[model samples]
Target chain A: MPATRYRAAPAATLSIVSLDLMRAVYHRASGRTHLVSEPVPEILAALADEPLDEVALLDRLARDYAIEGDAAALGERLEELVATGLVEQL
Target chain B: MNHVFAVRIGPVGFRVGSDWRAPIDTLADLYRDYPAPEDGIPDFSVRLFARRPWRRVLRPQVMIGGDYTIPDAAPLPLSLGLLAAEMGMNLQMALAQRRYLLLHASCIERDGRAILMTGESGAGKSTLAALMMARGWRLMGDEFALVEPETGLIYSFPRLVSLKNQSVGVVGEALRGARFGPWQRDTPKGDIRHLVPDGASIAAMAEPARAAAILFPAYGHAPDRREVAPGECFVRLTQASTNYVALGERGFDTLTRLVRDVPATAIDYPDAATACAMVEEFAA
Candidate 1:
């Protein structure tokens, strides 16, 4: 069985503003503004570089950020991002 | 049309036509200080008309219609025609204007910098802005703050300030010689009246000012104030804005810049005096 991978929309498609507590993302593709916090923005930024499965993405996030959640939490955040069209399941 | 009035407020112009003379007469008096629309051409037209010919006189009800309308909006009595006209103009701007980003907030300016106050309907923002104006701050606008997307400057709308319930008396007492419209009692939003902005505010409507800060005010609480972070400001402003979704990227860019450049605060007060003092302290 293969692990599910995900990719984010290109950097050009999103206008991201970093506020201290959260990020305000304006998705150009859908012309909608979304406010995201924590690992959601981190996941999108990590995936913007390349497609990553659950394990690879988590590894990248842990190396760069002080991540508190485990694999299941990361999976839930990815699913929510995918539903919002910010992250695509590959 | 039996009567017509034209006036320009900040960057927008309105030409109002009506079937009866009373409402137009009221508008003409209220907006007497405002200049006619540029070259006598209005950007929007508001029509206060009767549903039927006989409705004009028998039991006069002013139905608001214009460039944009709610379609199912209930008519107001002839006595409340000024409100209908004001509502008609506001509807047109809310539904059709896209040149600038519109925030449902009250704004006051001092020393070329503007302060925006936004909250829910009964948040007392309007009353606070009016009170601030009485204390020498320039009233930029009451119902809407027009933010120019290109420059991120706040243009003064400075329309008549709609005072509801206790606020009518509060502002009336504060602005001793200021002109005001008729008081209509027991309407949808309780007692209602409108106050014309000072001559200085009307004269300087075209000049835009830099936004210095954002304030979210809540009335009927013990006076307290706190700093708001950029993230919270972004969320509150998006909800406050009327044309954010319509402007898309432009709106996002402008709002981000505003949130980043200005400080935001939330103030809760039990009375207008406390709110005004707190505002003065902050502005100082």
Candidate 2:
């Protein structure tokens, strides 16, 4: 699993916002909120610190989410997250 | 006979009258006219109290009876005043059974789905909601729509769409041949109530819509339509909801699910006509 980074801001300074059900926790420290609902922990672990392509990301998410059996389920969830602005292709 | 309904909302209760009742009945019809995509049982119920000969039931916290006259005090926020003066005994009664949620909004239906027009007073959401109704959209309610939680559905309770001072002309002239109540002058909120649509279509509360779309209508001199990302819409709509806070965890989950499935947008229009067109275009 890749190193998991947890960011927090002191007090109620952190503002939380959602787009299309994508939850983002904003850090008053940097004014940029991390996408908390993207299953960051799961995806990072599946990626294993390696720079793989989009297909690799999908594979990791699907495997972690157990989408091998459901097939379309993992892909659909990812598309929804993308629509919510939580995940973006580099 | 006290011509008032004592309505208890959460912890607050008020005496309301027929001016409020008539609209609620109208809303029921509107709901029936355009049944929700998934037809469901109506939540509105009527109860008879033998001891109180003239009383009518509106909601759990509210009962309709007697006569109510607009207070002589300065008009409050026209929308708030309308809510405070609701005649629909079943309005709040219906609220208690479902999730007790209330919003200052105007609702209209297109393609059998209800799209809520909500914002703070003076945001022109009412005018926009009313204009949409004039253009064939069914009226829900001018001031509020009670949303049922489990289904994320809306219950219609039609009432007069309020038009304060300058808005009277802006809306009245645009929807030409509109019917309006006499304008009361010098109220706290200033004279109001330009027109009450022929809200006859309001019969039953709509089977709650799945919130197919959310648009923050911005009326500007220059017309523009801003396609809002769902994330922004989710943030705004959740905040705008009547029971967003009260619904607690369940409410949060329900809202998240609804926004996920709906397309949210921010619309700008120069006038009522344009606004109506935008709603139709989007709903289609």
Q: Best candidate, TM-score-wise?
A: 1
Give the per-residue lDDT of model 1 (tens digit) for A18-68. 888889999999999998888788888889989999999889899878676
The segments of candidate 1 whose C-alpha lies over 4 angstroms from its true place after superposition are none
Tens digit of per-residue lDDT, candidate 2, span B29-133 = 322233232222233322211122322332212223222222332223223323333333334333443353554456777666777666556667777777676
Score every model by TM-score: 0.97, 0.56
lDDT of 1 by residue, B48-127 (tens): 99988999979998899998888688989999988988899998888888988899999999889899999999999889
RMSD of 1: 1.3
**How many clashing pairs per prediction, in order?**
0, 35
Q: C-alpha displacement of B114 in model 2, angstroms?
A: 2.2
C-alpha lDDT values of all predictions: 0.91, 0.52
Poorest lDDT segment (10 consecutive residues) of candidate 2 chain B: B46-55
